[model samples]
Target: MYQVYYTRDKAGRITQKLETIEGITHSIDYSYDLAGRLIEVKQDGTVTETYQYDANGNRLNNAQYSKCTTK
Candidate 1:
């Protein structure tokens, strides 16, 4: 089994997530614009994803996700 922990802002936006698997844990931090639109994700303190949107709330482009490394 796995475990997931989340931190949400008062605006009901998930600001962070910590997931555990096989007793190992990894965390991702979320960022948003003032309007609460998702903008970026930092996995283990390095950005691994990005997002963009249009004024009409349509996704302008595909988000990027890649393996995160710790050095």
Candidate 2:
């Protein structure tokens, strides 16, 4: 069986998600901008991925985001 848990900040934004399966625990942490847009994803306190957007909130291409694990 698997279990999941979530944590939220006072501003009501999701801050973390944790999942447990077969005695192994995995987690993902979240960050947001003042506008509440998701900005970064981390594991074990290391940033592994990021997101980009135009000023109007349109998703932007991240050709410069070298940290992305998948192309």
Candidate 3:
């Protein structure tokens, strides 16, 4: 399980996030344009993912990955 906390700026722009689970912690940072368009998202001390959008606010691209392994 994972829990997340969100922090926003006065403009209501989400600037940071903290995620924790099972004693491990991960942080995420966000940046938005003046138009409030999300331009970037960074996690776990790395720029592991990115997002892009079209003029109509439709998601054009997103890059991320996840996997589960059991031994």
Candidate 4:
């Protein structure tokens, strides 16, 4: 069985997650902007994802995946 652990902020938001499997450990970290919007994601201390939002809180694009279009 694998083991997983999480670290949270004062507000109970998960700030970091650690997992161990087969004697290998991996970590993921979460970051938020001032407005509490998720802005970045890191895996093993390397940035693997990024996010951008519009003024109205609409997701504009995701750096790791695809872009969003407005109709």
Candidate 5:
């Protein structure tokens, strides 16, 4: 299981996140434009993905991937 702690600004905008489990910690940071639109998402000290949106707040594009591992 994973747990995340989120930090928000005065306007209740999520600015950062911290994930921790079994004594290991990871961080995610968020960036926004002047219009309060989410522009980027960075995780574990890396720029993992980015997001783009239309003027109507509809998601235009998102960069993401997934992988699986087996023991």
Candidate 6:
């Protein structure tokens, strides 16, 4: 079996996750807006996905990026 670890924010949100197998490790990170909404996702320290929300707490759109792009 592999091992997985997680880091969380003060509000108990999952901020990062790491998994290791066969001496290789992979990591994913998450970011949240002030309202505790998911705003971004990163892999290996590079932004890979993003989310936008309207004022009503609804998801506006989701975007996936090739390489690291900032918006």
TM-scores across all candidates?
Answer: 0.80, 0.74, 0.65, 0.85, 0.73, 0.86
lDDT of 6 by residue, 17-49 (tens): 998988789899999999999999998888999
Q: In lDDT terms, how accurate is model 1?
A: 0.88
For lDDT, candidate 3 versus 4, the one ahead is 4
Best by TM-score: 6
The residue-by-residue lDDT of candidate 5 on 12-59, one tens digit each, is 999899998887898989988777888888877677778888988877
Worst 10 residues of 5 by lDDT: 60-69
Ranking by TM-score: 6, 4, 1, 2, 5, 3
For candidate 3, list the clashing residue pairs, or say none.
none
What is candidate 2's CA lDDT for residue 57? 96
Q: Comparing candidate 1 with candidate 2, which one achieves the higher lDDT?
A: 1
Per-residue lDDT for 10-69 in model 2, tens only?
A: 988889989899988888899898888888888756776788899799868542223445
lDDT for 56 in candidate 3 is 84
Report each candidate's C-alpha RMSD, comma-separated, in the order given.
2.4, 4.5, 3.8, 8.1, 3.5, 4.6
lDDT sort, best first:
6, 4, 1, 5, 2, 3
Q: Which stretches of candidate 2 lie over 4 Å from their true place?
A: 62-71
What lDDT would each prediction earn against the true structure? 0.88, 0.80, 0.80, 0.89, 0.82, 0.94
Error of 3 at 5 (Å): 2.1
What is residue 27's positional error in candidate 6, in angstroms?
Answer: 1.4
RMSD of 2: 4.5
Superposition error at 50 for model 2 (Å): 0.3
Which structure is stronger by lDDT: 1 or 5?
A: 1
